[model samples]
Target chain A: MKFLSNLINGISLGSVYAIIALGYTMVYGIARMLNFAHGDVIMVGAYICFFAIYSFNLNPVIGILMAVVVCTVLGVVIEKLAYKPLRQATSLAVLITAIGVSYFLQNMAQLLWSANPKVFPTIINGSIKLFGGELSISRTTIVIVLVCALIVVGLSIFVNHTKMGKAMRACSEDKEAAQLMGINVNKTISMTFAIGSALAAIAGVLMCCAYPNLQPTTGSMPGIKAFTAAVFGGIGSIPGAFIGGILLGVLEILGSAYISTELKDAIVFLALIIVLLVKPTGILGKKIHEKV
Target chain B: MAAMLEVNDINVYYGSIHAIKGVSFEVNEGEIISLIGANGAGKTTTLHTISGLLKSTTGSMSFMGTDLMKTPADKIVSLGLAHVPEGRRIFQGMDVEENLDMGAFTQPKSSIKGNKEIVFEHFPRLKERRHQIAGTLSGGEQQMLAMGRAMMSNPKLLMLDEPSMGLAPILVDEIFEIIKALNKAGTTILLVEQNAQMALSIASRGYVLETGRVVLEDEAKNLLNNDSIRKAYLGG
Candidate 1:
């Protein structure tokens, strides 16, 4: 029963990681650059939620909406201003630019909101009784898991069934060929950034409900962990990110419960090292050898 | 007749190295024009330049009365221009059907059903492997898939670069046959090939490019019968 409770908690935590990981994976798959700013995008999202809810006195749903809108626009602007010009530059140049953007976003958030942590209101209040309230689950955990699942399903359908989605896949496969096929590669890339950032918004709001705390750096730890999840699942593979996030979440929770509370983060990183050393491509990732 | 595609005094350079120097040519409507040259002789570069893949420094390229110089590469496809690039750059990760879907990306949903049927008729092998991953197909099948994909757009002008590269002799013959058939069906063709003999056989007219310059241009039979062309390109 305790094991089941830990499993559910792990799943909920992992769902948050998976939400963040999707942003990293989709952008990386299409643009072929690790978007280091993705983690900070989550911070921006959380700040937006705080502004809309606490300052403006809007409803929780409305706050989430604003967060999504702001993060999506922010993502598109960043892509156009920073990443677009560097498309033809070397990977190292692009990597450094991404790191620069990440740092820039972090600093901007820190400057805007200051370094102190703020208390976040619970969006989804109350816990449900399971096994006569002995192993009850929090509303936040259920909401996170269900929301992540919905987004994941929606993403797969969008990618595999829609025209724009097919264009995205084609762009990832061969950008040059996609261009010849009349796909507006720029539009496709922008859309990818938009969707990834939109998901980050929801993940950010859900994160506030779970942790009930908002800080400029709160997103950094989860963002990095989710990136590790993406790599663990196979960087560009969608299901891989989902599965990797869940596994990482469960293991971290279970490890903390059974082993050492303080060593939970260390255990997660250790697992990442082990998985990478063994599989290299993550669990579901396909080997992407550079085409000659 | 007015030219459907015109390239005037085009000079393309690759980072200080002049690749296509003052190259000029024209393709009239409903004509098969072949540009035959050896490797690195600027044949592919010319095709890339014309299709907006590579921008020329000082030249004017107009297609269907549209100034190609200002248009981006992705936008060029919707202007009834398609390039079946060298190396058959098919989306290897996608299935055959998905590849065809991408080819018809710019078209309205209502047209794809018909266009796909036409492509399947042109290359039944692609239809046979419609659900199979494109990379798993044989080299010959991949070539056919590439051509089929190009055809999906129903372009007024179709450009092919080395369609016969690394294919079996029989497959090469089959590819040329398809090229001729497509030309007969009213699509203007600009073919770049090292297989000069095969390219010249079906083309209405031909240009022999030597080091980024058009040294020879004549009707198909005249160029085919020329002793200089025969010695240099046909390997007589």
Candidate 2:
């Protein structure tokens, strides 16, 4: 019963990481750049949600909506202002720009929100008893899991069935050919950033609700962990990110509960290193073979 | 009659290297115009420039009276112009059906089904492998997919670059036959080829390019029979 309860908590936390990893996987898949600033975007979203609900006395849903809107705009603006000009530049150059953007957002958030941590309000209260009250699952955990499932399903359908989604896949394969086919490459990439940032907003809110500690740097460690989840599942594969996140969360939780709390992160990363050594493409990544 | 496509004195540069120097040509409606040259003679560069992939420093290119120079590369396809770039750049990751869907990206959603059917009719081999991953396809089949993909947009002016580049002789003949059939169906063709004999045989008119200059221009039959052309390009 204790093991099952731990698994549920791990899954709930993993769901948040999965949501965040989706943003990292998608932006990397289409734009071919790692937006390190993705974590900072999460912080901005959380701050927005906090201000909307606590300061303005808005509803929780309205706060989430505002966070999504602000993050989406912020993601697109970041791509346009920082990344677009470096399109013809090298991968190293682009990577450096992304790191620079990450630092900029971190500093900007500190300036606006200050360094003090704010307590995140509990959006969903109460818990459900299971196994004759021996096991308990928080309402927030269930909501997070449900939301994650919905997002995964919705994204899969959109990518497989929609026109814009087809365009996105085409651009990922060959930008020049996609252009010849009349798919606007720039617009598709911008849309990717928009969707990714929107997901980041929801992730930020859920993450804070779980930990209840909000600060400018709240997004950084989670963002990096989610990035690890993306790599664990396979960098460009959506399903990979989901699977990777859940497994990472389980490992981290179980490791901390059974072993040493101080060494849980190290244990999680060590497991990743072992998995990568055996199968370098993450568990789900396809080996790229270019035909001559 | 007005030309279907016209390019006047286009000068294209690859940084410091002048790739296409003051090149000029025009394609009239319902005609197969072949540009034959050895490698690095700017045939591919010329096609890329006209399709808005590369910028030209000095040139006036128009298709059906629209200024192509100002048009963006993605918008050029909606203007009824399509280019089958060299190497048959089919999306290797996508299936055959998805590739066709991408081909008709600019067309109305209602037309995708009909366009796909037409493409299948032209190359029934593709219909057999509709679900197959494109990267695993044989070279000849990949070429067919490339041409069939270009046809999905129902282009008024279709530009083919090195369609027969790495195919067997029999497959080359088969591809040329398809080109002729496509032209017969009223799609104006601009073919660039190193296979001068095959290209000229199917084309109504031909231009012989050397070092970025059109050194010879005449009816296809005339160029095929010209002594210098037979020696230099036709390998007589």
Candidate 3:
């Protein structure tokens, strides 16, 4: 029964990681860039949600929506301001810029929201009982799962069917050729960041609901975990990121149960290292052949 | 016949390397213009400059009366110029259908279906492997896919940068045949090739570029008979 409860908890938590991982995967796929500031964007989203719920006394759903919109706008602005100029620059320069942006956002968050953790008002305070061993599923878990599933389905359809999605895939595969095809690479890259950040924001709100705590640095662990998931499942593959997140979540929970809670993070890192060592291209990632 | 595309004294550079220096050429409407040269003779650079991939530092380039120098690479396609870049830059991760769809990025939503059918008709192999990931395709198949993808844009001018690069001899002949057919279909072509023999044979007009300068420009047969061109590039 305890194991079942842990399993459920792990799944719910893993769903949150998956939500954040989507942002990482989408942005990485499109730009071939690792936006290190993505984690800070998640933190920003949580704080935005926190303010909306606490200060304005808005409904949780409305707050989440507003947070997503705000985060998306911020994402676009960041791309224009920090990334656009560096588009033609070297990979190292772009990477350094990303790290700088991450640090700046973290510090800005600290300045605005303060360093200490603030308790978020839980919309789903109570727990529900399930069959057999009476699994305790919170409203927060349900919301997280529903949101994650909806985003995944929505993203899948968007990438596979829509014109914009096709453009994005083209840009991801070959930016220069995509441009020659008349797909605006800049606009597509901006859209990628916007979607990625918006998803991160939603994950933030969901994380707040589940844990009911907000901090300036709240996005760090989740961000690293999500990044790990992205790499584990193949950084550029969306579906791969989803599966990686869920697997990571399950592993963490199982580790905590059988092993020590202190070693859970270490175990996840160990798994990441082992997987990368075994399959450098990842399980779902395709091997790329560069023409000589 | 009025020139459809004109390059007037254009100068292009790659860092410190002065690639295309004062290079000039003109392609009349419905003509196949081949720019043949050695490896570092700015053949690819000229094609790239005209396609808006690399902006020339000096001189002017125009396509169908529109100024191409000021235009962005993405907008160049909408202006009816399709560039099949060097090394067949196909979307490796995308399937054939998706890659073809990308070519129609600037086209109206209504015309995509029609254009796609036309592309598939030209390259039946692409249609057969429509769902297969592009990276998995063989070298010749990838080249075919690249050409098919460019065709989906329905361009007035098709700029091919070494389409025959890394292909079997039989495949090369087949590719040249397709290029000829496409030219006959009224698409103005700017072909950059290291295979001077095949290029001069198919091209109505030819330009020989030597170290970023236009050393020779004449009718295809004239260049085939040129002493310097035959000795150096055409292999006698």
Ranking by DockQ: 2, 3, 1
Report the lDDT tens digits of candidate 2 across residue range B1-236.
76989999999898899989899999999999999999999999999999888999997999999999999999999999999999999999889988999999999989999989988888999999999989999999999999989999999999999999889999999999999999999999999999999999999999888888888899999999999999999998
lDDT of 1 by residue, A70-184 (tens): 9999999999999999989999999999889988988888898998889997778799998887899988899899999999999999999998889999999889899999888
lDDT of 3 at A224: 92
In terms of TM-score, how similar is model 2 to the real structure? 0.98
Clashes of each: 0, 0, 0
Per model, kept true contacts as a fraction are 0.74, 0.76, 0.87
Model 3 stretches with alpha carbons more than 4 Å out: A290-292
Model 2 over residues A1-292: C-alpha lDDT tens digits?
8899888989999999999999999999999998889988999999999999999999999999999999999999999999999998999999999989888988898998899999998889999998889999999999999999999989988887888988898898889999999989999999999999999999999998889999888999989899999999999888998999889888889889899999999998998899899999898988757654
lDDT string, candidate 3, A190-271, tens digits: 9999999999999998888888778878888899999999999999898998888888998998998999999999999999
What C-alpha root-mean-square deviation, in Å, does candidate 1 show against the real structure?
Answer: 1.4
DockQ for each of the predicted structures, in order? 0.66, 0.80, 0.77
Off by over 4 Å in 2: none
Arranged by TM-score with the best first, the candidates are: 2, 1, 3
Give Cα-based local distance difference scores for all models: 0.91, 0.92, 0.89
